[model samples]
Target: MNRPRSTCLAVALVATILFQPGARAQVTGAQVRDAIADAVRHLKARQQPDGSWRSRDRYEHGYTCLATLALLLAGEAPTSPPMARALNVIAHAPDEYTYVVSLKIMALAQADPEKYKEDIERSARWLMRAQDESGLWSYQLNPVNYDHSNSQFALLGLNAAAQAGVKVPAGVWQAARRRVLTTQNSDGGWSYTFRGSSYGSMTAAGVSDLLILGGAVVSPVERGVRNGVAPGCGRYREDKPLLNGLRWLGREFSAIQNPGHGRSNLHYWLYAVERCGILSGLQMLGRHDWYREGAAKLVSDQRADGGWGTIENTCFSIMFLAKGRKPLLVQKLQWSADDDWNPDRNDLEHLLDRIGDKLGEPMSWQSVPFDAPLERWLAAPLLYMQGHKFPEWTPNQREKVRQYVEQGGTLFLEACCGREDFRNGAEAFLAETFPLTPLHELDSGHPVYHAYQDVAPAGLMGVDVGCRTSIIYSPFDLSCHWEQANIPLLGERAFDLGLNIAAFATGRRPLRDRLDLVKVAEREDINEPPPPGDPLVLAQVEYHGDWQPDPHALAHFAEYLNEQAGLRVAASARATRLTPEELPRAPFLYMTGHYAFELSGKERAALAAHLRRGGFLFADACCGRREFDASFRAMLRQVAPQGELRRLEPTHPIFSGSPGFRIESVGYRAAALAENPNLSRPELWGLETDGRLAVVYSPYGLGCGLDGHACYNCRGILEADARRMATNVVLYALTR
Candidate 1:
């Protein structure tokens, strides 16, 4: 009761309980796929004129057979030409065939039993004839002594025969069991004929054989494979010999032998782990990182052809890569909706680089964030970065933008706080120069919100935030340099308006396409040293390396624009670095740390006039903000009455967008996402204007309050405010 059965029972118990919920799966499915791929490569390499591994007189038939079996287990269709050829060669091979072809063929036939019925039947007969009267088939048909490899192969083959309904001679099983017992050394281990090499691989195989054939507990074979005997058992001396075998196999596999190699055998070793089900045994052996190391090696061994070769190297390489698939294909995110604060920026590359550093393991597949339009953010989020400006558009850019807009586009613009001296600085466009469409706040109940719902903040912030990747805001904004009067402000108006424009324009296209056409709008507050669209002061961002736009990539270029280029209105949407389908619906989309569309054409002049027209503006930190706000103010001039954008009150209509007036945004004095449920609706909460003066305005969480203007309680929160603020803005745009 307390013997061999316990160990076998343990193996069974582990298998059963190991798959429970949260019980991390073993050797992920991908590893298996890769291992199978490796087997295919090996078989492919072995293919000869007959479509099998046989070099005219080379006599590597056994190796070829082994390779075929491995590939067959990989789902290589037997009817397939390569397999058919291999089978043909095997049929014509010399006599005395014995490499467990029957067992290997089992997997091949299982895929389509009828097609390989004759093959299986023939193999069964071959095995029966190959078996000796003593029940065991040793190496090359005859053996002097009994022990691990040879004995286990016979049992394994016979076991397969039994499973397939192939008949074996009477008393065969009983005799094999007895033969195993006789070979058992005093210590519970069994020695090879003369006791040579002992190792884990051999021991594992032995354990499998005993379990498959003995059908008894505490069988001498069980101890022989598992822990080895204490010393004295019976007269066989098999115990020491078996332990020695395991030692040999273990050292053999573990020994880092790179013998002047163009490629190491590590890959094959990994393949063998899976092929031999060593992964299961390793787990039981408590080798936690064993599989991971194997995976790492696999990654290093990949060839240009995307396939593996050799039974020893390529096998492990493919299996290891496949095993690590779960983690590799995991696709991580930097900012989850559940975060305490929402970040604003348009730099996707920065986020990618950060996460890439943390991945530890390299990813083999292509993954992107947000499969939908870029403008569907939950809030009218802002994108802010420092220093660099976009490169001048190529000859095709104007056409692209024109085409993009005619289809439907909404781009917003604004002045920076640091450059607020210029009048009508952040207008949609310079009415005096480039007269493009003047961007007014979009009309209330516009299609932007209605794309998914008719109301504001329909899905909590409503719909989805569309911020597929992590976002960041600028550390230094507010740089007013307009010849006209400039106001100090981080134009939330511009950001929101831009969102509507982009959504209306590019929603039909993809985020990637839209990113291709956008040009950073010149801040109306800043009169450029040169003309806007200066080729000398521009950059480019693209996925493939061929184009190498002057701006380089999004993360680098956008950050440069935000920090060094003194860019006020930036348009940054990074595809490879960030995934954007995570946030709630908003008018404008922000990235790692930048905004899109500063201001161009008539929009710039309109903004200038709008400010002079006493229009109000709101801004705030979406995520961590002290630096972002500081940078934003640096770009403002008289643009904002005060060089600041503070919170508003519950009475603000922007808060009216959703049911709950509460502003539980990502960043705030405290967070309200917890207590607030009805967060999606429409209400007017910010500034209600009659086009007179900027005297009456509230800076709720949406942001307001500065110099001469003071918002009550720094934009007090209400029961239902975000929706109201949204409604208020729509109404403002409609009337203004």
Candidate 2:
């Protein structure tokens, strides 16, 4: 009902002033109407209990003048009852109200015609009386009483009135512009009711008004205008009064950058950034996607009330809540022909059939359609957020996924939908664990793009397209906008690569798919037990989930497991194998050629128990049983959340010696490795809070699927990935 708190003061470019007259105005006729509406609400409230205004209430002068300026701003001539009542109220106020009232008279002039011109002339004359020879408006004619806050508002009212076509004296405008600009702070923000310190509200008021007024100022009046682009005085090296103003306006309390800065309670910055459409301006400045992440932060901070409000913090909080009204789903879906994408039952059936073949099996290749009839179209590699559930899995896929984890394979997904809901369906299908695991903002610093830059579109693509990709280039499409759904073929160099997205979300302690952080002890205590700890039992068994292993591979796995765990299970015992009871005693099992079937019945139970009992099981398929990943997954589900296992990395103490072996050296070798790869796809694995592996695969495996497979030869994975795998196993087993 009242003005939304602070009545007047413009942000950035809004404060541009005109000395001679209107030059280039940012405040359009329509925008002025909106601003006026805001000002009037507050002015009307300031019409005191005494049929007059009181200077004690800063609201009185600021809003009254703001209302007048808003009306003048739009040339909305007002002589009607509302205008006359406003005028009468101004007349009843004291001398302290003179500076503000002058603008009021200026506004009243627009509505009164020549027939009633006397009022207009009289109003301008009264305004002249408010200014002193010093060229600045003052409180009770006292300069000290009138600081940056009051003075800036008064001059803005003056500028607004002048721009409204009123014949403001040339000298009055020039003097006022100078007075205001000089008071701005180095930070480009304003302090409490004045100069120096920068407050979000004032920064908005001052900067907006300055840009607006300056935009309207005749060129000569701005001959010495400081866009704040020089090193004269300001935070940035550039003279960016206007830019800095906007920056301050958006920079309330949120340190939207570093992970440590800006808590959820930081409300002001979010408020300013959202309402200011700062992103739009930044785009104009060529900083693409600059505000996308900020927009996300606001969305994440929304309150349960669907509104952001904190007592008096309501104005900004509400603005923030309203900033990102909805996820910026590219192709912003509306209920139209494309709503369902299509409606012919035959077409739907065809798509369904294609999906069946593309995925081969229903459960294995996930596509969960939400129960809501409205969501029938989200069928491809869709995604559902944590809040939702995946469609139920068939009994077979369930076991299949379970074994896949045991075998150490990750499920990668790329998803996007409009008014449609794919993630909703995805939730129903992948009911393994981490229904809500989300994608973190992938910075340029991430190595995904480096993994295969031109070969595949590898960037940290956010789940929401509009938020991630600012400008989609496409010479192929009719228009320039590159629509992902339309470009069926891999367009020149395009593919939403989410290799780690899936591995990061699922995997058993996958060695090569994620953050392979291994502390390198450049200097180890040579006198003490060696890191390799007496050769560190460098034994490894390469398990390719594609095919079952021969007895030799099994023997390698068993012997390596026995040695790493310090168990004396002889290679001769390979025929019957030691039971689960004998397996836990071994501290480690560093073998590859992963296959749940090769694992004896006792081995599987012992492996699960071993994990629970802090046993380490490093499984890296050496390309033997490529398809048995399902088998591995099926087996591990029986132990913990299938999503828990992740790939290990080059740094997992295994690479502590070399400190560089990763996916590039090896290959993406589960079922089959990628060709002409940009990087290697080796993974490291770990457990979560419940002792379930935190990683099914490495989320930060640098170049896992890019270059040649590091696991191409039996010697490669064992010599490279195997060493790290061994170290992790030995350490985990001993620690556990």
lDDT for position 283 in model 2: 14
Taking the tens digit of each residue's C-alpha lDDT, what string does model 2 give over 282-377? 211112122334434434444544333332133343333333222111111111211121111111112222223222222111112222122111
Structural RMSD, model 2: 23.4
Report lDDT (CA) for all predictions: 0.33, 0.35
The candidate maximizing TM-score is 1
TM-score, per-candidate, Cα-based: 0.36, 0.27
Per-residue C-alpha lDDT of model 1 across residues 52-72, encoded as one tens digit per residue: 554323335655555455555
Off by over 4 Å in 2: 1-84, 91-95, 102-136, 192-195, 215-239, 253-736
Error of 1 at 660 (Å): 29
Best model per lDDT: 2
